[model samples]
Target: MVNDDPRVSPEARTRVKDAIDALGYRPNIAARSLLLGRTRTIGLLTVGSTAYGPASLTLATERAVSNTGYGFRLANTVDVDIDSVENGLSLLLDQGVDAVIVNEPTSTFRHRRHGLAIPVLSLSEPLDLSDVELVVGSDEAGGVKEAVEHLLGLGHATVHHIAGPQEWPSSKRRREAWKAALEAAGRDVPDSIEGDWSAASGYEAGLEFAKRPEVTAVFAANDHMAIGLMRSLQRAGRRVPEDISIVGFDDVPEAAFLSRALTTVHQDLAVAAVRGVELLMEVLDGGREGGTIERVPTRLVVRETTQAPVASS
Candidate 1:
């Protein structure tokens, strides 16, 4: 009756429930796991900076896990190196999680093997490793392509890019997509300024861009950087959409509330996170296999920040 075993008679079960409610009894998780041979818990190993995207994904995943009636454990590592990833994984494994979700977005963990007994899901790029059971990633390329095409369609001569750190797979995918969109449209592909996914870096890039009259349009990797870039451009006496236009990725909650109402890419991290949990459940239930990669689509939300370039005198 305590474990809710169906063998108990209705009268006994009712008595047990009434007594339990009276005493406010709680089940012992460790003891239950010992008896059932499962913890019913999901572990998440997140490796990277606490950027808006990653941080939101973590929270979304936690919510998804809880909604599915599973316990959630999280171990975070600031560094993207292999050692940090391994340490984080070890910490989660030590807690006896039934499955693990790896959110390492760096190149180092993309194909690495983690010889774990339980199922593994990766929320970063798709991995071909034998140990990883499933992969769920946002459509980094699609959103970037849309943003670039929108800029070009607005009559910008060429769209300059402020790319995120090269180490992250998401950054690489966005940068590649930006370049591919320009090439496909027969537009000149300018050199990209690499940012560390930081507003400071974006502001720095904007300072340089402000001096270049040829830079009529810009695509920032994320909204935070876009905000910073817009600030710098405004400080330099360049009016957005009049002298220069900007588009950003990751349509954050604050994007719409900005002074210019940023035009950006909207990728729902919660959708991806929920799908990841569902896939992991399938794997645990022996219904899904490893090497399954899922990409959630993104869309462009055009707002006030982007427009056709003004004719130069």
Candidate 2:
């Protein structure tokens, strides 16, 4: 019996049949890669923010590459470090990576537009790719809108926001969605506080909110801040749901076990990684033109952290 999977090329089938008869012949993919001026390796250039999301994405890329019998290289750069990004790009090029995957969360990404000689597949918010090969990312705007609407559906008067740094395109998208949701619902949009996407930042922001007797609910951009916000609210003598309701983005594993659990947006970071790799491969194989944009959707994960605001005691 012959397996007709298109993934198994004709030459590969002949080699496999011969190898089965010989009982042990192996193909040297590395040598073949060299003959074809390729390294059989993919490079992932990641930005060093969103620790948990990027980590999950990396794992997914690794798993996908392993299953496809390809090798991968990864490089991470700090936010706003041009030198670090250039250095990482140079290293990947020197390593002869077949293609590149850009996992930076920016709308104005330059690496794929002007930097590298190889094709680039970007994992970012849907933006104009212009000359880049393919782009993959979450529909963050929609996700944020859904999350905000969920909070409104729970009967909150108005949802206050603790946003991530403005430089990140994701933060901007979520902010836009938050505003849109509020506008559509005829709710007042308050002056939002900016956080560094850290638990400490959320805690500090929560302290400010605690001082406002009218603030009974908040929407943190990420789960880490939600945790901090919860802590600060607790310290301020406010019981979650009983006094103030809270919602967060990125349903991290710990969100469920928090003091009151947490309502959050669930972004499948692993899927983003796999999709990014696949798009890179397509470009490397010349299966598609550069400058394609892809967007994956996100969902809201409701738990114990959010509810209607209680009346003032």
Candidate 3:
């Protein structure tokens, strides 16, 4: 009755249910897995910070897994190093998960042998691993292009950039895109200041930028950094969108509510999560092949933080 066996009589099932309810009984998931030959649990191995993007993706992926009537497990890695990634994967595999989703946005897994027996999906750039079944990522290049173009269209001679850690593939993509856009428009590409996807790092970068009087427009890799950069600029008596226009990535919930609302890129993390699970399910059902890559779209949200650069006297 606990296993929902149709062979059990209705009266027996009712009695068993009543007894279970009275005793607060719980079925043994391990025993169930032994009998069914499957755990019906999906595991997620996330690498890196608890930043808004990673955290939101984790929640969205969990919800998508739950909506499909499957159990979910999570394992975290302290860093994107090879040892940390392998340890995280081993933890998930030890849990006997049906499949694994690796939210590793770094290049640690590229061209490496994971030796995973179960299906694996990645939420980063497409990797050359035979064990990885699929790859799903956001259109970071497209968003960066839009932001750079918007700033250039506002008559800014060039747009400066505050990039995320160079180790992350997404950060590398954004930096490359920003550079490419500037080069394509015949604009001089300035050296980019790297941040650790933290507001403090952004503030530090902003302090250096504030010293450069030629900087009229700037784009931050993420909103947290943008917030810190804005504060530093304000402390230096530089008004946003007046002295230096600012653009940021990841349109977090607070982006629109800031005193000077952030103009940023919005990534559809929920859609990416749902599609990743859906593709993993297809792999589990033996209906899909490995090595498929999907890129989710992103949009630029124009807000108060961006405007035409003021004419210099």
Candidate 4:
């Protein structure tokens, strides 16, 4: 008998009806899993807990899963341990997770998805999505272009660049965009210094870059490195903006309150996390195997760190 009580919402009734329509039994999702080959649960693997970006992403992912009314199995690794990562994934699979979201950098996660029956989703960093069903990445190139364009709009000379490791897809994209913008503007594109996505690396690079007389404007690929670069420049007797302008990517929390402030590209990590979950859930919901690439937009935030290059006395 169909119960059409006023207290029961139509959506609730519809969900119950859908289950009945699927099969003659009115079993709960857990009971139906065996018959339908669905686990009603998701797995998320993330990087070290120490990193702010990854930690925030983990929280966002958990919230997304909870909103969907699905159980989640989460694992965090302190270091890049392939064995531990694989072990954690194996355990999640044992728990009957319907899909997996791997927050590891793309390159590492790509190789690990081999022979997995369920769909795998990768967030951040570029990877060979051949194995995984879908991958979501930040639009780093667009962010770099936006940052450079803002500096140019401020009447600064061509922007110099400090790039992260060449192997990281984000770093490569930002560096390419910076160079392309310079070429398009007919500005001299100096060779960019490399950093290891760390403030110390940025500081070291900044020290050397400060020696150049023509380096009036600089852009660092990530916020940590940007701060380090700024500090190094200051320690080397260069005044930000007044002496040489600077911009950075990532727009981390500290960017605004820094001594000179920071003009940076803001990559919306929360938005990216939500989009990644959306794409991953789409695949897990028996949708068509869609294209693998999903690119989230980025924004440029103007601050006190940038100004017109001062004329050398």
lDDT of each: 0.88, 0.78, 0.89, 0.78
lDDT of 2 by residue, 1-313 (tens): 1445778988988887887678765568978787888788887777766557666776776787666667878887775456777677677778887777766665554544455566767677543333556777787888888888887887788889999888777788788889998999999999999998899999999899999977877888888988999999899997887778888988899988877889888898788777777766666667877766777788888889878766655
RMSD of each: 2.9, 3.6, 3.8, 5.2
Candidate 3 residue pairs in backbone clash:
none
Q: Candidate 2 — which residues are off by over 4 angstroms? A: 1-23, 106-115, 126-132
Top candidate when judged by lDDT against the true structure: 3
lDDT tens string, model 1, 1-313? Answer: 8767989999999998999999999878778788889998999988656799989999999999999877999999888877787788788889898998877775464235655678788888755434747888798888999999999999998899999998788888899999999999999999999999999999999999999999999999998899999999999999997999999999989999988999999999999999999998988777887888889999999999988899988
Candidate 3 residues 95-196, lDDT tens each?
899888878766565336645677778887765544657888789999999999999999999999999988788899999999999999999999999999
**lDDT score, residue 191, model 2?**
92
Q: What are the per-residue Cα lDDT tens digits for candidate 4 across 1-313?
A: 2536888888888897888888786437776687778888989987665444567778888998888877888876655566766666677778888888878632554344355777777776534434446777688888888888888887877888889877555677789999999899988898899987889999998889889877888888888888888899889998888877888887888889987889898888788878888877777766747457788898889889888777667
Q: What value does the lDDT take at residue 306 in candidate 2?
A: 79
How many backbone clashes are present in model 4? 0
Q: Which should have the higher TM-score, number 2 or number 4?
A: 2
Worst lDDT 10-window in candidate 1: 106-115
* Global Cα lDDT for candidate 4: 0.78
Reference-based TM-score of each model? 0.89, 0.87, 0.87, 0.81
